[model samples]
Every structure is written in structure tokens, then in C-alpha cells.
Target: MRRPSLPAWAWVALAAHALFVADARAAARFDAATRVFRLDGERVTYAFGINEAGQLQSLHWGGRLADGDPLGPAKSLPSHSSFDLSASITPQEFPAQGGGVFTEVALKVAYADGNRDTVLRYVSHTLERDAVTVRLRDIALPLEVSLRYTIDPGTGVIGRSARIENLGRTPLRIDQAASAAYTLAPQDDYRLHHLSGRWAGEWSLQQRPVSEGASVLESRRGSTGQQNTPWFAIDRGGSSGEDSGPVWFGALAWSGSWRISIDKDPLGAVRVVGGYNPYDFAYRLAPGERLDTPVFYAGYSDGGMGGASRLLHRFERERILPGGGKPRLRPVLYNSWEATEFAVDEAGQMALAEKAARIGVERFVVDDGWFGARNSDKAGLGDWSVNRAKFPNGLKPLIDKVHGLGMEFGLWVEPEMVNPDSDLYRAHPDWVLNFPERPRTPARNQLVLNLARRDVRDHVLQVLDALVTDNDIQFLKWDYNRNWSEPGWPQLAPEDQPKVYVEYVRNLYWILGELRRKHPKLEIESCSGGGGRIDLGIMALTDQVWPSDNTDPFDRLSMQDGFSHAYAPAAMMAWVTDSPNWVNRRETSLDYRFLSSMQGALGIGANLNHWRDADFATAARMVAAYKQVRATVQQGDLYRLISPANGSPRSATLSVSPDRRQAVLFAFLHSQSKGMQEPAIRLRGLDPRQRYRIARLGGGALPEAMPAEASGAYWMEHGLAVPMRGDFQASGFVFEAK
Candidate 1:
């Protein structure tokens, strides 16, 4: 993996120029003589350069530097032992497989001539206002790799990805590929934080010390599995806390089968490599063909875990979400799943809609059982037509009724799945992901359609297009109930069958993009049997996401807490369902339920048909109260004052508006025994100079000694006391700047 040496004078000139020429206003800069590139954000700077051996190396990735910080060239580290070569010790920006490296290679390929090693060297580069693309070529092969770097000016987050091209005359197989590898500076102790859980229990924050080996977080279930999310944060031991300390965080903007490996070399160099999972993964590129990796976004925060989350949330809202930097607020939705699961009909739905409207539900959604013979999950999954038996006049009458009641209409749809007994499945049995002579596995009584196929992709796009076009549908609860079983693409050559992992997701994204382009007003929610398919990739296409199917108020508190670390509240949909919840039968008070759901995009999933007059009144009052502070909850900086994790008896959250005009606080007490007293809730992210008027939601009494109005500084310093006496009790307050 050696390369021709550059002139001695050239190296000296580049080093001299890079050390002296640094513009504070420039987002990106490159030193050609030294072959160094630097991207500067508001508070962070990422710099990399080529070493003498012609490999791209990471230089600096932390706090912002001054105009002349003296960042020298990328030098390869000396080998500590015979087993650890210089190439393995140096933190190459995008390492290839042929350099005697053993940590984690970013790119690995199998050539047509039976070669399996690839060593990429710097070739050329391109620079832009906020981006830089560096080209690398195989030392002796026609395989070229282009690495891209972009930074968000407001949130100091850097996005890295790679493009692999086959410039040879024959085809080549990519055995392993990653977006990019990030190297962390040497430190004494590093603790890694990630999210992991099961179907009913998702987003459990898990942490461990970074040891002397590799820790891999991945999803091989075709979509972003509920087992582990594609996000990670690391902080030095002893200094990490909820609100203050140094932290580094990143998330992979990929929804398909993906992997992120955090490795600590024996020499103590820590690196993070992430991209398409190499588990049964392969992509064959023909001559002149290319494959692009997903974007891996990383950021640094000196404010601790809370600071890291806040930065990521702001970045997702302004950069990743669908609304061009200003997405719409999540509407107060009423889903009729709990009321009537498989008994949905026009009369029943209209009655439910009428009751929902009385309670001020802005959007009425009829979930499941409205189309085909979808009486249950066992049949009629792929049949996209309306059921004549249930809807004799189609969805028009119900949609019109909902509109007339001053509410938008939404429907449940599972376009990527088909039951074995469905008409679509029977007609095109070959459309599923199956081997020629293998049994097609079924989960939830459905099989995943081979969306990687062009025909199947077109069919799904066409049906969804027509459904939205024919009806006044404002939203779609797009769900994928199962993962891939026999992910075989028999239509393509046998050698290309393994490409399903990449093509399936690409087509899915394409279909969603096409649907949105066709119908500008239509909104979509990504649900995969609960928080199974949520990530930056899916967030870019959909408006909101169903975090989990288990809507029990108490269970959701922990899930929502973990969810907020990586995603924005605007995209997290929380629903208030009937108590004596089906999942755990945990019965909570109506007010408690409302307060829990009100933390995020609020929704009602309770059976209004069974509710008494008192229930309706309570719901109406809560809905009205939520509307008053909806903007702040949906689009504001969140502060988790007291975490509900580890069986904590009390939990509290505060949402402060972006402009600092208003702040909303919600506090919950799991149980109080022996008259245990709780501490006052101090708020954050409020302007200390402004005076605020405190008002309780739902007409609750304030603390006896506390004033009704006070300066933000006084409130923050003195705090406010709220009552917490019984189990499952909740309270909310609105602090309006006066």
C-alpha cells in the first residue's frame, strides 16, 4: 500500500499555509499543499489531512479553534508491536481493507479477478461553501471512493458519507461498506450510551464503559429494528451527567439493515464505523456504476447528555424533517383503534367521529378494518380497495362527515405487507421475498412484499396514489407489521440476490417521496408494529412516528424519555388510550393519562363510546388546555428535570418555546408512601430577565407560599412547589412571559 512521495518543499509549503490561513467566517477550507481539509461550525471544527503514505487521516474533531490554531499535517502513528502496523494504528478517515489493518475497514471489495483486498489512496478533491468531497482511488485497481463532509452551521453537527464507483470494465462485488469512520481523541475513560429494547418495550437507554474491544449496534431485520436504534453518545467517565459535561453523539440516517461498530484499539484509539450491515449483505456494481452510503451525522457538546440531545433535536427539526426547516405541528388526533378494532363501519365511525369532535379532536383517524376484508390482522392486508360490506358508500361519506365536523380524516394502511389469503397475494404469489422452493415465513399472518422489485414497487405506489386521490384523506398511518423472512430476489441473477437489503429500502423511500410529490397536502406516519422503524432516514419522509404500540401512561414515560434523546418531540406521537391498558392492565386516572400524552404530539385512543359524560368533559378540558401550549411542546427546547428511569417515583419535563416567551411543565408522581416530600421543580431555557405569570392547567391550586407571577430568575432560583400525594397523579403548569 505504498505511494510515490511528494516533493519535500511541497509538504513544507502546505503545512506553513494551513497553520496561518484560517478564516472564522468560512465554513469549509482546504490546504492543497499540505492536503488538509477543515470544516468549521459555530462551536466545532473537523479537520483531516492526507499522510505521507497517501491515506486520509483524521486530525481534529472537537471544540472550535482560533484562526491560527496550529493544526499540523496528519501523521501516521508508529506501530506499537509487530502485530500492530502503522496503517492499523493511524486513524484513517476512510480505511480500506488491504493495509494490514484489523480494527474496522470502511470499504472492502471482491474484484472480478478473485482479489479481495482494496487500499484507497488520495487522488483529488472538491470544496464548497459548507461541504468538501475527497476522491480516493485503489492503489492498483479501478475502484474509486469519494468521501463527502458537510456541517450544519447552527448546530455544529457534521454529516459524512461515501460513494463507491466501479471504474473497471467488469463488475465487482462490495463485500463491506460504511458511510465513514470517526476517530475520538485519546482519553482515560469513555462511556458509551445507546438505546435498546423489544417490541412492546422500546428505547431503553443502555450504557457501558468502552472496553478494549468492539461494541456493535445494528439491525439485520430489514428495517430499523426495535432491538437497537441507530444512535449513540459517548462521554468521559466521572464527568458525564444529565445537564453538564463533554459528550460526543451521532446517528446513522439509515432505516434498512445497518450496523455501527465502536472499537477501541489496544493502543487506546477509539473509532466509530457505521453503514450498511455486512450480515448477508453484498452489492454488485457494473462497469461505470456507483453505490452511495447513508449519511452518518455526528456532533460534539460540552453541556452533557442533555446538551447532546438538545443539539440533535434541533438538528433533526431544522435539517432532517420533511417541512423545509418548519414542519407543521402534530395535530390533536383521535384514533378509533381501541374503540372498535375490527368492527369499523361507516355508521360506527361517524358516531365515533361525532364524539371525538365534541372533545376537540382536530384529526379523526379510522385505524384498521375499513378496507378489504380486514376484519382482523389475519386477512385482507394487501387488498387496498374499500370493503363494500363495511363501507357501502366508500370512505367518502365518513370523510365528508369528519370534515363537516371540522376535523381532518386519516386511514390506516399497510402497503408493504400482504396476507397469504389476500387477493393481491394470490394473484402475484411471486411478488413476495421467497426462494424458488422454500417456505415463505409469515409474521402477524402476513409476508413482506418484495418491494425491491420494480413491479411490486410500482403496484404499491399506484394503489396509494389512487387511494389518496379518490378520498379527501389528510393523513396515512403507514405501517410495516413484519420484517423480512426469506429476503430472496429471484428476479435478479443468483449472484445479485443479496442486494435486496439496499434496493428494498431505496425503493421504499422512492415510493414515499413520489406519494408526497403527487399529493402535497397528504401527511404520513411511519409505524412498524410500534417503534420498530424509526430513524433519521424515515424521519426525512414522514411527518410523525409511532414510538411504541404499548400506550400505557406509565410505560410510555420511560420510552418517551429515551426517544427524546435522538428524535424531536414534533415527530413523536403519544396517544391516550383506555386505562386498564391491554398491555399491562395498568389503570391510571384520566388526568394522569392526558398529562402523559400531552408531553408530545397528543392523541386520544380511548373508547368514547363507553365513556360517561364526565369522561367527555374531562377530555374536552384537557384537549383545550393542550391546544393552548401545543406550539411550545411540539417545537421547543425540552428539559428532563427528573428522569422516570430506574423506578424513580417522580418524573418531570419542561418545554420552553424557542423565543423564550412561554414554558410548559408537566410533573408526574408514580406513588407516594409515608408522605415523602418531593423537591421543587426548577425550569431551564427561560429568559431570566422576563417576568412570567404562572397558571395551572385544569384549574389546580398553586403552592400556598408561591407567588402567581415572578421574574424568570426568581422562579428558576426559588423554584415552584406542586402537590404530589397519591399514585399515578400528574400536574401541569404554563409559565407565560409578561
Candidate 2:
């Protein structure tokens, strides 16, 4: 049967109507009669309502309920005592500091007339397909706040944030402002898990019980410090495992100093407040000026910690990263830092580039000595001009050579820093961050530029824009080697000095965004003395990150395990460096180092000038093997079969493709005494009905007892064992489903 075709506009109208219907099904719902709002994801639901007092109150947040499930209207809780009023007892969605509320507040303001109290109440709201915005105003003053809620239907992750505006004629001072507050029902036992570490050691998982007091995780060092990360997970009564039980996790998307407070009140209710740190922080807003806080992303997972991480990973890959959430794969990079640290020259760089290309390196980076008089970190930081002495013919010759060798050229840059002895500082000493008549403290022989100033921000953008425009650069190893010693903005008034903390970071983000907009093909790696500035904020702007300065294979196993709890392996840039690692002076085999680095985005930082023929062959083989399985390793479901924490003697990890057609397993042994046999590792996230063929990687035979092929059910149930018999040994295998 043939039917008459409709007009183009009619077809478009029909398609639009179908889309509207689908969106309506997934959209947030607000009941005007009961003053209740509900947001539903695939497997999770979040509900809240307005109380009689006009304050927004939390209702339920957990597993999804049936469409007709009844959620009663919001009501204020009774006061426990005179000190704890009803306002404090009730779980306010966004609590202000006034109204007898003693808990961590979402907003704190000081009016011009010496009033510091603020009580916010619901005024109105607007809803979209997957988002909702609610407006609240102070009961007396002309201060307004807007709360935003966005949900991802596929992963059941919700994003929350708030915006503050001043409607009065006079200026208002904001002392404390948080993005969102999440409340959890009382449980028998609540356990908190977070990540913490230092310079040579980062991403160490720490667990503790949630007591009646506040447990604060913060970064006070301008950038996201290594001392703590802005990610957390809470499990009820320690009932959750790697892949089972209930867990709630969240991360704040801010690269500047931030805070997350987990407070378990005396009445047994647990509340989490996260946002910009109030320490040495104040923002003054005049009439009509507004400030928007960073988004706080969170989710619920009945499948446990592993499930929580997997959901977060998928959300980040599809929503947070660049390229409209579909970021490109990280290339195999070779950096010349270890080989020619401060002695970089055109000839030396080209020679290293040739060697790198021979081993399948797709990008060649010249680190730390191509510009100014940068013989060492002590000088030549702010000077962005090419060093005529090192590169007599300029960077074009070296870049052309690298391109001819079939690799992209990259360079290291630190635009946010300047050496006191550099030409730029000598020209404009007032450009760096400093206070009047106060001695400027320098870290790593450099001072942080006052990016808060428009002049300084423009200078940085111009320099970087010219660098990429003049050269055929494809990637940048953006490095920030030190923290802020004294953050100040002398150009602004005394009352506005505290705004540096917020403006500095905003300007940094602006510069990065502008650079990407100008050069669409360029990619960047965010490095702040190694894992010091990695967060959802920076990850959204950069392609990958350097996890740590300590490349010791053994230490990396533990670091990688902890890192996987919050971040995707696709953004982790692991480098295979020298043995007898500079950090620990621990010697490990080259193969072990390769295996460790293969778990993430692979990069080689070894000094090829010192390698033997056997080393080259080994590296070439490992690089090829990594190329074959990188998609699964970088963008697949990671299963931690054996954890390497607490100095465990053995560790193993498995990566299964999203389609379940392939899997890769990497196992390591620290030391085996008395021939103690390790247990077989059970596989996960595989299709039970399909058959898979086992294949060995890095040229080794499979176990004699293992079969060549088997059903996924048999492999997952019975497991497989790989032979390991020495100290610092590693092996890997691939399973191809047929």
C-alpha cells in the first residue's frame, strides 16, 4: 500500500510533537495543589516540597517509586529543645543562616544597614524537560536566590547549584555561599569514604565513621590541593561492597578552594553542605550584580561503590567533558622532560622526536627550555618569547621535523606564573599578586600572576594565543608548579580585596576557554605539581591530567585504585618512567612499569638516549598491545577484582567493553614467598550466553590448565589464573567474545 507524503512542515510538526511527548515523560513534575516537586531518573527519584512556613524541605531521595506512589506534603519538624528550633530540625532544602538554624548554611549575607540575618522562602519556580529552577527571596530584605536542579535520565545523576542576586540599592557582602545541601535519612551506621594525599602520594582512599559532629573535606590552597579531593561516598552501616549494597556519592565541580561538610546532627539526620570555601573569602555585590555557584553533582546507587563510580564515570564522559561530551581518545605521547630537562635545543628535541616516533608515539612534547632564558626554574618564567640561543631558527624547524616524522608537536607552558627575574615582571612588577608594602613570597622561584586584573588576564590570553598561532602546536602540557603564597589584588579597593579568590579562578577558566575557542583542534593537560588541581571543573576544560609525580609502578597501583573511585581512567595520564624511580628509589622491571601505565591513558617519559635495543623492542611491543585494548581500558566498565590497598601482596583489575565483546585483565605481584599460590580472579560485566577466546598479551603463554575457549558463564564462574612467581612481576590477558 502506498500513502501520500505529507508536506515538509507537517512532518516537522509531527516530529516536534513526538519529542515533546517523550520529554514530558522524563521531565520533572510539580504539584501546585500540594506544593511538592519530584524529579525522576531511570532508577532514582528526588522529591521535595514547601512547608507551611514557606521554606523548601527535602522529602525522599533514593530508589525510584511507582508513578502513583504517594509522597506526603512537607511539614516542619518539632523542635528538640529551645536551642534547636523547628527551623533547625526540619531538613530545609537550602537553609539560610537566620531563623535559629545552627547547621551549615547555604547562604550568609551582611546588609549595608548592619543586618546579617536572612530567612529565605519560596516565591516561584519554572520547570523544563530535565531541569527545574526555583526562586526564593529573603523574608524582609531585597535579596533573591535561585536554585537549579538538573538530572541525567540515563545515569540517574542529579546536578544542583544556586545563584544569588542583590535587588537593593546599597551593596551587600556575602560571607558564605554553598552550591547545595543534601540530606539523608537516619541509619544505624554511616561510613564516609574520601580521597586524600600529598606531593609524591595522591589519591589515597580514606574511610571513617560518621559521628555526631562535622567531618570537613576542604582545599584551602587556591587550587584543588592534593591534601583532599572534592569527592565523597557514604554507605550505610558498612553494608556496601565494591559491587553490592546501597551508596550515595557526589563531587563538586570547582577548581578553586572549596569545602564539603558532612554533618550528622544530634537528632541522627545526616546533611552534606558543599560549595566555595568561606575562608578568606568575601564577595560584595552591588544592585543587580549576581553570583552563580559551581554545580554539585551527586547520585544514588543500589549496586554499591562500584555502581556509584560507574554511573559518575558515564555521566562525566557523556556530559562534562568537551566535544559535546564525546571527547576524543588521548594519544600515545612522548615527553622530553627526563631526557633533556633544561637543556632543550632544536637538534636535541628533533633527535628525541625521531626516537619517540620509532616507538609509536603520536605526540612529541618539548618540556621546559624552549622559551626565554629558562635554563632552570629560577628564571625566564614570565618571558614567553622563544630563546634565540637554544633555537637559532625558532620553533618552526623542530615542529616541522616532528610533523615529518609523523607525530604532532607539543610544548610545555606556565602562563599563570612569573619569575621575579623575568622580563615581564621587570616591566610590570605590579602585575603579580601582592599587597602594598608587603613582601611578595615566592614558591618555586616564581610568583602567581594576578589574573583577577583585566590587564593581567589580557596579557596571558595574548601570549598563549600568539604561541599556538605562531607554531604548529597540537597539544599543551599546561603546568602550574606552585601554590599561591599570598593572594591579593592591589588594584581593587580594600573592601573588594577578598574577591581575588573567586576572580582569579574565574579568569583562569576564561583564558582556557578562549584558547580552545580560538583553536578547536588543540588539546591540553591540566597539571598542578601533579594531581593537585584535578576536579570536575578542570576536567571539563582539559583533555587529560597527570595523576602524580611519583611514577613508581608499585605505588601507582594503589594510587590508581583510589583514583578510580571518583574519576574515569580515560582522563588519567599515566607515564612509564625510569626504574629505581626518583621518588622511592625502588627498582622495578620495565614490563611491570608498562603494565601499570597501560591501565590508563599511556604516555612514555623514559630517557630514550639511555635505553638498550632490548628496551626499545619491549616498549614497542607494549605500545602496540596497549593500542589494541585501549578502548576497553579507557572507556569500559572497570572491575576491581583484587585491591592493592594497605600493602596487599597481589592486585588485579579487569576492564570490560560497553558492548561486552571484549575484556582486558592486568595482574601484579609485589612479592611471593614460599611459593604461595594466588587465587583465580573472577570476571565481571560479561555476557553469560556468549563464548570468549582467551589470548595472552606481551608475548606469554596462557596457563596450561586454562582452556582456549569457553562460555562467558564458565569463565565468570570458574575464573582464570595467570602464573606469577617473582617480586615485582606483572602479566595481562585479553578475552575476545565470539
Which candidate's TM-score is highest? Answer: 1
In candidate 1, what are the lDDT values of residues 128-233, reduced to their tens digit? 8789899999999999999999999898899999999999999999999999999998787899999999999999999999988799999999999999999999
Q: Model 2: what TM-score?
A: 0.96
Candidate 2 regions exceeding 4 Å error are 1-24
Kindly list the per-residue Cα lDDT of model 2 for residues 1-738, writing each as its tens digit: 975698886766566445434554764877654567888887999989899999999998888877647775789898999988999879998999998999989899999999999999999899887999999999989999999999898888889999999999999999999999999988868899999999979999999988888999999888898999999999876578888888989999998899999988668888999999999889999899999999999899998888888888888888888868777888999999989999999888988998898889999999998899899999999899999999998999999999999999899999999999899999999998888899999999999999889999999999999999999999999999888867888788888998888888899999999999999999999998889999999999999998898889899999999999999998999999998888889999899999999999999999999999899999999999999999999889998889999878999999999999999999999889899998888888889999999988776678788798998898789998777898999989999987
Worst 10 residues of 1 by lDDT: 15-24
Error (Å) of candidate 1 at residue 107 is: 1.0
| Runs with alpha carbons beyond 4 Å of true place in candidate 1 | 1-24
Candidate 1: residue 586 lDDT (0-100)? 93
The models' CA-based lDDT, in order, is: 0.92, 0.90
